[model samples]
Target: MKSLPRLSPTSYALLGLLARGPATAYELNNIMQTSMLRVFWPRADSHIYSEPKKLLSHGLVSEEKEKVKGRDRTNFTITAAGRDALAAWLAEPDAATHRNQAEFMLKVILAEGGSPDDIKATLARALETTRTETRMAIAGIQHIIDSPEAGVRKGMPWNGMAANLMADILIARLRWAEYATEAAAAVPDDSDRAAKEDIGLAAYQRALQRLQAELDP
Candidate 1:
């Protein structure tokens, strides 16, 4: 199998959104929040401004100025290159590996300050979020599967495959959350040890932030 070119997940997501029609950055953000938040890329206002510029630089998308409510705004449309990129990504056999462990790690770090009640509350919230997200992902995928238009796509399976992948990820994460909640509940509350651990973690976090600033600046 040929290896695909490296593109951040956000890039492909923006391309996919543009495939539907031209849209301003604000509109894309709204669409993401309303419809794609559970099923697609992680939501960030940074991506709203950044990803399109990257796509535009790569010749995958084009921008036009339009007037809306007396102010000129830029609208982005997918180029042929963009569409091709999106289609290729959709059809690609290999699934991208995700780096999603940071969220779990963040919770571990924050456990330093959490009381037993706080832990229980946090666990309950985590479980609820996992369940709700999984449910939404499943429903979103099923909607596509049941839609008459979805069957007629050049490769119907491929179209559904992306949504299915999301559903699978959500389900897997839900299971992980269930396990994590039980394990967390079993741990004895040790605030002193947690505080010591947090001191180390805080140093590491500061170093990481410095590195991030250096890299991005």
Candidate 2:
């Protein structure tokens, strides 16, 4: 049996989208831009435009061409092999212990190099973004519940579950940002290293307590 090509997470993400239905790359890019994929698995438009061709080369997806307005449009659909590959990827165990939030967290970690206002602004932006995302996620769930047709409703159990997870993470981030923003604002300009360490220790303790509570039955 021929081995499947080693695919990146982005490749699998595209395959998952194709599994839903046939779509032109433009349609897929729009979906990525406007849907939960934007929040969960964002990619650059250039990458989105090009990945379909790679999937086609790997025989994971098939392209159908048609003429619209005398212009060639290509639609991609996942092949049987694509479905098998996706299933296999899903079945593989995820070794990651935590979700990566390096982009924002890195700023948080290195905030001492900047002023307290800088960190506060970072936290404020995170808070706002996560709040918006949380609202969008809830709205998405409500849409799925209220949709008349089965097309949007077809995702059912899995989609709902995934949305719930997304909302949970967003809410967690929102809460963290709120707390961090408040704490950063409270920091005194004259605070010495020991004072800052004390503040950080307190924050760590609070987090530990929260984690312990969560772990409790």
Candidate 3:
């Protein structure tokens, strides 16, 4: 038997969305735009439009067309093979090499090359964005609770778990951004490089202690 082609993460994301029910690419894009999926696996509109076709070719999804108001509309639904693939993917252990690809995080990692003000501005932007996301996450959770029969609420325990995780991550990012902003503001003059190093070292030590406590507790 021929081995199946390796699917990209985007393919799996689309399959996961279809697993909920049939949806057009437009519907999938709308869901990604408005939900925690956007927070985790954001993709371009074009990619969303095209990935479903690829899944269909791979025999993982089936497509149907209907006339709605005299215009053809296409919807994609997960096939049995797609469900098995998604289940196997979910069962696989998370790759240890996985790293955050957030641009703001990249800037933070490279902040030493930039001026203090530049780093401070990046942190400010990140904090503001995270605050907005946190609000949306809270609103989403509230919506789920308010409308138990809504389509988005179909995945009972998993929906709640995913929403809670997104909210927790956003809260953690908000806290980190606040701390980094404060630390940037406290940077001493160039002449006191030692003091700056001390500040960075202290922050590192605090993080290390937190990890150690988590491991022990």
- Give the Cα-based TM-score of candidate 1 against the true structure: 0.59
| Per-residue C-alpha lDDT of model 2 across residues 3-60, encoded as one tens digit per residue | 9899988888888888888999999898888777776777889988999999999999
What's each prediction's TM-score?
0.59, 0.89, 0.87
Clashing pairs in 3: none
lDDT of 1 by residue, 118-140 (tens): 75777678789888876776676
Stretches of candidate 3 exceeding 4 Å from the true structure: 1-3, 69-71, 91-98, 189-191
Evaluated against the true structure, the overall lDDT of model 1 is 0.71
- What value does the lDDT take at residue 142 in candidate 2? 88
Candidate 3 vs. true structure, TM-score? 0.87
Q: Pick the candidate with the highest TM-score.
A: 2
Give the Cα RMSD of candidate 1. Answer: 10.5
Shift of residue 107 alpha carbon in model 2, Å: 1.4
Model 3 RMSD vs true structure: 2.3
